[model samples]
Target: MTVRDDPRIAMLSVHTSPLDQPGTGDAGGMNVYVTELSQALARRGAQVEIFTRATSSAQPTKVEVAERVLVRHVAAGPFEGLDKNDLPGQLCAFTAGVLRAEARRAVGWYDVVHTHYWLSGQVGWLAADRWDVPLVHTMHTLARVKNAALAPGDAPEPLGRIIGEEQVVEEADALVANTDAEASDLVADYHADPARVHVVAPGVDLEVFSPGTLGRPALRAALGLPADDRIVLFAGRVQPLKAPDLLVRAMGVLAERGEAVPTLVVLGGASGRPTAVRELEALAYQVGVADRLVVRPPVGREVLAQYFRAADVVAVPSHNESFGLVAAEAQATGTPVVAAAVGGLRTIVEDGVSGVLVPDHDPRTWARALADLLGDDVRRAALAAGARRASARFGWDAAAEQMLKVYELAAQVRSAR
Candidate 1:
């Protein structure tokens, strides 16, 4: 199939802006995925414009984040205090803003529409139909998949979301999944058409995340971390879904066993709830690992790479992950990951090779894994070497090349219909 030349893309991210800082307030891997993917697409000659809901009045209506990538912030509901749950009520307004923006442009300005998350998919459904363009949707997280793996005391995803996702699956010209496992889930759980599903693994910025020349002790000192103490870094939102509590509890288990306890570094801000960070701190206190716990807000990508490099092991205990970006980034920095053997983590971490994958979320199991890895210097060094090799498979350039093909496929399907 002949690929179209530089297809213009209208990228929709209604719930969160690609400009937003990841690891805080509903911003996570999805934001990074959109930002990096757009930049990569642009580098390949694609002109991309991302539309997102305006969270602050101070933001400009449009800003060029990269050479060929633009972010347009559309006003929907009140900028402040509106969460993901509240954004669904504002979809109509958000969609209207998007349509109005396109109406100002020449006819056929956008060749295709690519949307991130379900909320944006809802907007893309109508915009693509109205504009006669193909729609490609990436359901960063699925409602049914997440609900099925909810953490203890975590609320299930709303019924409204399930219905919304179903509609998007039915309407989208193509559905992008982060892993083959996720593609299977889309077909089995969402009952999506197998022909429409495309598995495109996301990539890490190896230039930014690669192992730096600085050694661990020097990197730790530069990052103001304890040079001599072992560090187990958990980089994600402090939420039930992320399972930060399990790490704290695991620290307690390590202490109980009279084993050497590594300092637990929690790097992220409150998400889902305003008091999530405080709650995590309280949990650390309850587990008697408060002194060993360090809470830091999220940093930019370069600094985050340093944290990954300084750590002995990065722990990702999320209840579910459509894709484990944190684990991949850590591994890219030559840091071994200790992740739960679930969803995308299973694909990212190679047990006894790149990193160890705990079979379950048991605190004792995590504690043992952490202790064993931290204690075995020779094994850890071997895994670090393997990690760098393992992470080499994913690159934004390759992901963009495949995505361009998917865009072409979506266009073909739309034209056929």
Candidate 2:
């Protein structure tokens, strides 16, 4: 039987929108992770409820994504799009709002609570304490990860997340990590009990992202990509930290070599980062590859699949990614990837097998790798086949089954307590 047979799961994903829209600034991985995992869990006969702060006054009382998966937007304070680090004081109030939302539901609605980030961990812990439910926590990104990304002098946050994260690691029934790297980081940095942590990699929607579904020529035609030109696609928000400029610079090197083929297609919209667009445009002009660059506005899932299918390759040049949904999605579409060798991308993209991983900051090295991969159709075909094979292992069905194991463990521990 699935954990939903117990009919009690409350997911706390505050500070990020539901899977419907990728939130600004933070990684889109968390929102996708929660949504896909919850849906997967529900498919296994589990009742799952996801909670996020309502962004609009006209939103429905509850959004039913599936038969057993429901998303509830609890009423919180103003300023709809505030980042997590800026939402600490508002969490307690949000927690109260969640409790009120729950009160309106039937009794025994939630027996176990799982929270996404540290802020949501605090809120979930509060609800868990009051409702006497077991709390399971996932720290999608840690403070140390933030420290590694920031400069020596610039403080990312003054209050910090160590204390609240420590509480979740120590008190929550169990802590789940999306990768072994994250699990080890939790134990080493926060002194989280090694016995209390588990690693479950995130899953991709294989059904929707399958290869034959793309129809490359049609998709390319739809996107205005030339039939003869190779296409390099990049999706996700336009942000400095994402290192989008790195991709533009890499393409510039390819252009300088007179080997630039297949227009570089950028997906996703600017997230209040006006400078990022100017930086990319300036870099395109600097490289003299402006004519070969195409920036497609934000696209929904259907259009995104077309871009993935139409592309010769997808590039994920993140400075840090806890788990790479971009790489996974590209693989699911039977396309090869060129990614930065960091975080979860390292785990997803095998160096020469599934796709290519280049050094994090070296644009020339990235350029060489991209050129080599895109130029050799034989290698590209092999990588494409391998990527599709590797992606098959990450079906949401399997991921959801594994998550139920975590839920079962949490419930067993809670029952013992």
Candidate 1's error at 403, in angstroms?
A: 0.2
Q: Which candidate is the best by lDDT?
A: 1
The residue ranges of model 1 lying beyond 4 angstroms of the native Cα positions read: 1-3
Candidate 1 lDDT: 0.94
Clash pairs of candidate 2?
A: 4-46, 230-262
Best by TM-score: 1
- Return the TM-score for each candidate structure: 0.99, 0.92
Give per-residue CA lDDT, model 1, range 320-398, as digits (tens): 9999999999999999999999999999999999999999989999999999999999999999999999999889999
